[model samples]
Target: MKPADIDEFFRRLAADNPAPKTELEYINPYTLLVAVVLSAQATDIGVNKATGPLFQIVQTPGQMVELGEEKLRQYIRTIGLFNTKAKNVIRLSEILVAEHGGEVPRKRKELEALPGVGRKTANVVLNVAFGQITIAVDTHIFRVSNRTGLARGKTPEEVERKLVRYVPARWKPHAHHWLILHGRYICKARKPDCPACAVRDLCAYPDKTSERDMLEDPPVPVPAG
Candidate 1:
């Protein structure tokens, strides 16, 4: 896509959702950190299903530590890789309590230092929890990027770099959310609902749904004499 088109693409996205937010439900930075970690390879609905009850009980690193790995598994067992995620959450929580004084770290290096918190998770935490202009290239965003030719790349890191460079400064903050939501609801992996997509005309995908048949209205009946 051209630079101007990129700007307009984001303009439309931002206009539609002025204040985009992560789908993962959390009360604070700590919970948001843990939720993003758990959300890896899992759907937001799946993560929320587990975290809804888990957060009510474990709001802090201390609570997570006290919950123990065995108990932690019970809370997040529904998500994929529950065993690994449970262990990492426990480990990271302990680090937060001991190293960061129980507060989620705002810096990417500090966040990535935590177990199970990778570049993607760190980006999400920085963007959503700390209000930074970072984009976490998840599967949804990755697909959208390549499919729309918005930021074509073979890897997440490459896609992230392109997105940061191509996206307008004003829209960088919410770019991740917009792309993710668009891919999830409209430009899906299977049959995309291009006809309903807000940016379908602006999209570069050649296989997008045809807009030709969608007429505005039939000819109005002649007025009675």
Candidate 2:
């Protein structure tokens, strides 16, 4: 999209949700990191359901380490890949306690060094927990970016790079939240609600779906600007 359109896209999103926040619940950076890790391949609502009681007991790395793998598994057993996630959580908590004095690290590299914490996880931690201008490209953000022609790329990293470059500085800090929420609620995967979309006019998706998308033969093509 052109620079002006890109700015307008975010402007509408921002206006609709002036203070967008992660749907995942957390008390602190450590819990936030753990929530993001658990959120991999799982929904935010699902992760929150498991983490709600867990966070109350384990707020810091030391506390999480004390929770132990077996017990942690019991807590998150409802989530997918609970065994592996439990092991990673315990080990990463140990590392954090031993190295970072039980606090979540602000640096991206350090954040990624933790078990189950990849670039996307690190970006989320840096952005939501540390207030950085990083955009973690989840499935939602990736689809939204490509569908809207905002920052099309084959991979999430490529899209992240393009978004970092394309998004205006003023909107960079909140871009991730805006895009993710917009994608989740409006520009959905199976069928986007183009008619209700705030940025429908600015979106460049060739085929824009609406409320009757499920019953329709094909979605209507968006008109040229």
Candidate 3:
């Protein structure tokens, strides 16, 4: 998309949600990191449902470690790959306690060094927890970026680089949240709700679906009586 359209796209999204936030619920940075890790290959609602109970009991890295991998698995078993996620969470918690003094690291390198914490997860932790302007291009952001022509790229890293370079500096901090939410609700994969999209006018996608198109015909007018 053009630079002007890019700015307008974000402008509308920001206007709709002045204070966008991560859908994954968490009480603190430690819980945020764990929630993001468990969110891999799972929906935010699913992750939130599992983490809700888990976070109430385990806030700190030490507390998570005490919960143990097996017990953690029980809490998150509803999510995909729970066994692996549990193991990684437990190992990362151990590292956090031993090296970082039981605190989630602010630096990307340190965050990514932890098991189950890749670049995307590290970016999320840095941005959400540390107030950094990093963009973590998950599937949602990736689809929206490419679909809207805001930042088209083959890989998430490429899209992230484009978004970082193109998105206005003023909107950088919250760009990820805006794009993710838009993709999840509006610009969906199966059928984008183009009629309801705030930035539909600025969107460059050729296959924009409309509510009118989904219906056989316009609704008949109601009688005055």
> How many residue pairs clash in each candidate at the backbone level?
0, 0, 0
Which 10 residues in a row give candidate 3 its minimum summed lDDT?
Answer: 216-225
Error of 1 at 164 (Å): 0.6
Stretches off by above 4 angstroms in model 2 are 214-225
Ranking by lDDT: 2, 3, 1
lDDT value for model 2:
0.90
Q: Which runs in model 3 stand beyond 4 Å of their true positions?
A: 214-225
Clash pairs, candidate 1, are none
- Total clashes for model 1: 0
Clashing pairs in 2: none
- Give lDDT tens digits, candidate 2, residues 12-36: 8888888888988999998999999
TM-score of 2: 0.94
User: Cα miss at 129, model 3 (Å)?
Assistant: 0.7
- For lDDT, the strongest prediction is 2
The TM-score values for the models, in the order shown, are 0.92, 0.94, 0.94
Residue-level lDDT tens digits of model 3 in 26-59: 9999999999999999999899999989988999
